[model samples]
Target: METNMTLYHGSNIDFEKISLDKAKDKRDFGRGFYTTTIREQAKEWAEILNYRSRRDGCFLYEFTFEKTDNLHIKSFNGITEEWLNFIVENRLKGGVQHSFDVVIGPVANDRTVNTIGLYLSGDYFLDEALRRLEYFKLNDQVSLHTEKALSYLKFIRKYTWTA
Candidate 1:
């Protein structure tokens, strides 16, 4: 189906209002994007609320959760810095598109008492493509296109954020 792809330049508040359930529904209809675990989904929602990127262009952030054993605040702080560095190095090689427009942090979260989070961001372009893909009538073609887009995004996120 033909689509008029529009850039998603809405406010973080608007993104925060995006229901996870609705996103899941879109995923279902689209049938390609993986559904993240509940914990990860919650954290994504949190990021949407707390997003603080400069308002100039489109960007994507990857949030990583790691379980830790130490409870010392100092140790956790140190780890957070290391994690940020790791994400930064990885993002550099991720081949993110210029259209991505922003590269933000991997806002950490405490998943459990011992767990920590590391979030990373860069550019993203597939969101608009996915939105357009939603109009395609052929389910198989839609699935293929969505999967390809997801794979490309994942590759960029993974390689860009890792050393």
Candidate 2:
């Protein structure tokens, strides 16, 4: 990963600030500000959010992230046993599970979430969940879990995308 990277946050509403309080919990990385390195993925998120909110358009906010060694960072190159366990802990137990300021990893899709649910409900084993998750073509998500982490991301611009 580069020291400086471009990230995009997509939502149904335009915002000048990224608030962790406003973010939903039980996410893949717990409650945090999520951004993606892929623009198309961001766009898709915007569209999905817009539709869910019954909004006509969405906003794609761009940011420039300056990574520094001062803060703790956790990265997962792909879905693995460790990643799965970490995700399960965060999703099942709603709160910050780790001390990492930033976490870079694959976003759990709907199927993956369901698989996790099955695993939690005793319908699926750990190996089964991992096997199910393997089928997904995962997308990358960089989650800022702290205010200090948010400080590294500078808002660049915003684009309005219509349906």
The CA lDDT at 63 in model 1 is 28
Task: State the C-alpha lDDT per candidate.
Answer: 0.26, 0.89
Q: What's the TM-score of every candidate structure?
A: 0.19, 0.94
Superposed Cα deviation of residue 34, candidate 2 (Å)? 0.5
Candidate with maximal TM-score:
2
Colliding pairs, model 1 = 62-120, 90-160, 90-161, 90-162, 91-160, 91-161, 94-160, 100-123, 106-119, 106-120
lDDT of 1 by residue, 7-57 (tens): 111122222222223322222122122222233343343345444543332
The clash count for each model shown is 10, 0
Local accuracy of candidate 2 as per-residue lDDT tens digits, 1-163:
4499899998898888888899888878888988999999999999999999899998999999998897799999898888988898898788788889999999988767888889889999888888888889899999999999998999999999688
What stretches of model 1 exceed 4 Å from their correct place?
1-35, 39-85, 90-163
